[model samples]
Structure formats: structure tokens, C-alpha cells
Target: MDEYDFLGDVAVAGSVDSFDRAITPFLSQAFHAKSLLAIHFHRTRLPKVLFRWIPDKTLRQLFDKRYEKLGFMVDPFFHRAFLVQDWEACLLRDIAPDRFESSEYFTNYFGDTNMVDELGFVARIDNDTAVHLSMGRNQGQRRFRTNDVVRFGQFAKILAPKLRQILINQPADDVVEAQPLDRRFHAMAQARHTNISIREAEVAALIVQGHSSRAIGLKLGISGLTVKVHRRTLYKKLSISSQNELFGLLVNYVGADA
Candidate 1:
């Protein structure tokens, strides 16, 4: 079994802000890197800003120009892994390469660029969106390792649930009905579209029905710890960190009586 196999319990219950906080300190511990940053694309038609590193005005202008040249604005449902051979040329090409090269399944799209010598991953939030995450190590610092990428992927996997809970568990315009997604919450919607198993959905429904963790465990014929794990996974998948947040989101988006 893969290291993440235990996460299958994500199908049972929800509400896990404490768990999310619990795992964050390990992000740095799990991945060795010169730098790591994550930016959330909350809304569209606004500036595709960065919460982490401060870009100089000149660099910011160049980044903006790159976005315009990209032909596609950031939106949800976009996933790309990049390995850069040239940094300057990447700005010229306007395409971010996927970083996970060891996995045959994770392909790199922009290889001809002359500036990149490392890898990165970018996942957008909307079709009309202009959000992107472009993180990589310089040629000299530390070559991007598969294990680092794997750890980042794990962090992404965990972060997904929290984001999902936050988006779907509310009436926020950005969080639309799962059936007819408008492409705004593509990242969150896509997780629900795929990954979320039927058993998991059954668990979520039960949680909404006011089932306790122990009761849910009994109903599913699983242990209470298993139920607890599932609930945490669900919260992460839904972008929810707390029970109150889950209730609010379900009441707002799913029409579940709050």
C-alpha cells in the first residue's frame, strides 16, 4: 500500500480544522526545499495576486505580461507539472511546466523553454480564472527531487479536502452546485467529481444527518478511529476545518437543513 492508503477513511465524517493545523508544521519537515509557498485563488476578474513572495514591480509587470500571453486565463480544473531548463525563457514562453517527472502519469508540457532546470506544479481555480502557482528551485540551490515533489503532492492532497469543505459547504457564489459547475470552483469540484468514493459520500450524508463519530463507525462497521479519520479527510476535501463550517456550507450549498 502507498503511504496515503490509510487516507481512504476520508469517506466517513467531516470537520477537521485542528487536524489541518496539526499537519501544517510537518510540511516543512516532510519536504526539504529552499522555498515553498501556496496561494489561494479565491475569486475571478480580480488581480491574480501572490500572498507569499513579494515581486518587484518590474518582475510583477513581466508576470502579468506572461499571463496575457498564456492565451488561457486561470480558472479551476487546470493542473500542470513543470520542469524548467531556463527561467528567462519560461517568462517568454508563458507556460508553467509540471514538476513530477518520475511519475509516467505526470507529464511535462513545456520542455522546449531555455530557462528552466527544475520542476513545479500549477493548479488553477476557474476557466475564466487567472490564478496559478509557480514554485521551483534554482539550478544551483537544490535540484528538484522526486521525494520533494511527492511530499508537496501529499500536502496538496490534504489541503484539497479543506478547500472543498469551505467551497461546497457554503452559498458563496464561487461554490456552485456540483452538477452544473460554472468553472469557478474547478479545483474543489474536480475532487468531488473524481477521488471522492461512493462510500465517502455515504459517510458525508450520515454526518449531515447528525450521526456521531462512534455511531457512524458502528453503522459503517468500521472502528471509531477509522470514522474519525474519515471525518478529517472529508473536512480537508471540503475545505472545511470545523463542524460549524461544514454545517454552514451544507446548509448553503447542498440545501441540507443547517
Candidate 2:
């Protein structure tokens, strides 16, 4: 079928599941992506994996075991996409931090994925929720060109309204609520270390949440230097040196708590 026919069908899809099934085939064909993931973000809660279409068994297993569990915490694209309030699409590289490729998150989780590139669509569904649709190309494949990003943007404009409708019709209870970050960290820090201070724990929590030192300072009403000081102290107390290590520790703590 042509793009017009497929989009028309998607527009009239009766359910989110049906819309997803219809669109996945079209997207896979258009982008040459072997894996697709749709993640729903809720306010102050763990993001839900709304849908995943991965053809390779090994890749699926790795995603479920690692990426689904901990990698999201450190994903620059995941964090940046959610922060976006508008409906838009972009390549992961476009949204990633300047030094993202050299970061530990890249070295630890993303590097192992063997995926050459990722493109994402970010759509805000409500006041406190949004969804991100990611397309990944397998290793050794040529990266998406400029034209691909443009085409994906057009597709996103068509998909966003339909997805918003589907998500709006779901029961409110479908979204799980998580405990406050500070409370969770307080308990975890107490159980893990005796030398870490409350301020240091707060810094660590923000770091794991994907906030830069400047952002953390703004949120806490402190100077950037103070935030850095807290971060350095926290790193020393945790015996970790990089944000990647801090992310690993938080993920492990959260996983253990679960």
C-alpha cells in the first residue's frame, strides 16, 4: 500500500493496539529499521514500554534484560525527548549532548547494542505524559540521511493526533505511580552507605535523573558551583567518578528495590 492509504487507515484505527500494528509495518518498510520501541512517560513514574517490535531474538533479549531495565536511565535521547513539549521528530544524535558518544552510558549500554543509529518521534499526550517512538538500524548499516529525518518528521505529524486519541481513551489507572525520588533515595542510601549526606544524595538523585549540574542548581535554588561541589562530594562518597557510574548505582538500587 502507498503512504496515503496506510496513514488513512491509521487515522481511523479503533484501538491503540491496532494503530500500532498497522503503523509498525509501514515504519519498518520506510525506515529500514529492524527494531521499534514505543515508550510512554508518566509524571514522576517509571516510563512504560507501550510497544516493541524487534525481529531478532538476541537483540530483543538484550533490550529486555538491560535497556529496558537500566539503560533508559542514562539515555540522553530518552531524557531530551521527554523534555520537549512539542510534537517533533529528530535523530538521536541531534538531541544527544556534545560529549554523549564518549560518555559511559554510551560505552556501557548503547555501544553493546550494535545499533548504528536511532531516530525518534516525541509527542506530548497530556499535561504530564508523553510518548517516544524510536527506530533503530542494526550495526554496519549506513546512518539515516537528512532526507530520512525529514520523512520521519512528516510521519510524526500524522501519527501524533491518532496516538493522543488512543492514549486519552485509556483508563487513568493504567498508568502506574511511583514513589517520590527523594524518599526512594533516602532509603537506598541508608541501606548502602553511611557516609553520604542528604545533600549529596539529592545531587546523586538529580544526576541519575539526567539533570546537568546547571539544571540541578536551578531546581535547587543554588549556584552552579555549589551544585558541582555537591556532585563532587557525592561522587567521592559513592566512590564513583562519572555520571555513568552514578546512573549504574541508581539503576541497581532501583532494580533491587523492585
Candidate 3:
């Protein structure tokens, strides 16, 4: 569809629900995407999965079970959209790291997924928040062409203002705001009474806060090896094995608090 046709559809979208219904069909048709995932990023907090349209139950479960963990932190698309101020639409391959395919994030989380390619639209909702709309293609499908990216970027620019309005008008009661990971970790630790040491708690907090072992060590005036040891001890204390499990623990705590 042309830009005018797309705008006409947007014009009729009076609410968030209507906007979502209208746009997803258009995006699915226009890009030949198998699914969509919309994420809202807050400057100092974990991202909220605002909307998802994955039809495959297994893919959805994999996202919840695996990708919600440290894998997201390593995703170039997430890092760029969340950290960078400029908003634009781009293909995932265009921004991925040189060694992305060999990275643990790819091998363990993304590579196992059915998606072959992803295109993202970064829509700024406010100074501190942005909505990332991802369009995914399943395996055996062709990657996005240059003209497709250009056209999609143009469409995203046109849609941004309407998306911003929809988000701004969303009811506060309906929104589930994610608290900062470090704060949530502290709260979880306090409620557990699990004989976790202060140092271990600190390490765990930083880990959930998306800090690398080297970075945590630097912050704590210790070595990376010490940070790893503390992390292992903390995980053993909490009976969690992976970062995904730790993330699930924090999410459970947040839900209980809510």
C-alpha cells in the first residue's frame, strides 16, 4: 500500500487497540513478516513487552523461557534502540556485531528461534521511553531488500506520531511498569531470608542490572574472577542456574509485589 493509504488507516485508529489491529495486518502484509514484537524501553528499567503477535506457541514459549534473559541485553537491536536517542527503522543484520552468529546469545537464544531475519522500527514515545516494533521473517524467507528497508523506514516515520499519541493516551491503570532490576533484586533478596551475604546480594543485583562480570568487578573494586565466584555462589544460594532463571525470579517477585 502507498503512504496515503497507510495514513488513512492510521487516521481511523482512534485507540491503542484499534491502532494495533490496523497496523499489524498492514505490516504483516507489507513486509511478509511471520510475527511482530513491540517492546517499550525505559531508560533505567527493564523493557516491557508491549505487544506480541507470534502465532507459534513454541516460539512464544522460547521467548519467555530463554530470550527474556541476558540474551536481550546482548541483542544489538535492543542496545541501539534503548541506548541511542535517534529513532529510525533498520534491519537487524545491518546493526549486528561482526561475531554475532558465533556469540552465546545467538547460539543459545536467537539461533534456535524460527525467525530468520528481523526489522525494527524505533518510535520515540517520550524523552525517556521508546517503543521498538520488530518485524520478523521465518526461516526459508528472503531477507529484506534495500528498497524494503527504505520504504519501511518511511512508513515508520509516518506512523511514529500516531503511535506516540496512542501510547500517551493509554490508561495508567492498564500499564505494567517494570521497576529497575537492581531495586527488584534487593526486594527479592530481602523477602527471601536465604542467608545470602551482603556481597553476594550486591553481585546479584548488578548481574540483574545488566552489568558484565568485568564491569561488576570494577564497580566493586574486585577482580572478574571474584565476581564470577560470587555470582556462582549467589546462584547456588538462590537455586537458579542461568540468567534467565534469575530474571524469572525477579519477575515473579515483581508480580507478587504488584
Off by over 4 Å in 3: 1-5, 67-71, 173-258
Compare the candidates by lDDT and give the number of the best one: 2
* lDDT by residue (tens digit), candidate 1, 1-258: 233532433333243344323332343334333233333333323232332231234434434443222212221112121122111111212332221232111111112111133333444333432223334333245554666566556555545444335334535334322221123222233434635545555556445434567766887899879888877887777777765564444334433211
Q: Candidate 3: which pairs clash?
A: none
lDDT by candidate, in order shown: 0.39, 0.76, 0.71
lDDT of candidate 3 over 183-208, digit per residue (tens): 55766877887667778867765665
Candidate 1 lDDT at 6 equals 25
By lDDT: ranked, best first: 2, 3, 1
Give the range where candidate 1 is weakest over 10 consecutive residues by summed lDDT: 84-93
Distance from true position, residue 84, model 3, in Å? Answer: 3.9
- Residue-by-residue lDDT tens digits, candidate 2, 7-109: 8889788776888887999899888998898887765666788789999887788788876555665565556656777777889887765556765666665
Cα-lDDT of candidate 3: 0.71
Each candidate structure's count of clashing pairs: 42, 0, 0
TM-score of each model, in listed order:
0.31, 0.84, 0.65
Which pairs of residues clash in candidate 2, taking residues 3 or more apart in a chain or in different chains? none
| Of 1 and 3, the candidate ranking higher by TM-score | 3
What is the Cα-based lDDT of residue 228 in candidate 1?
Answer: 85
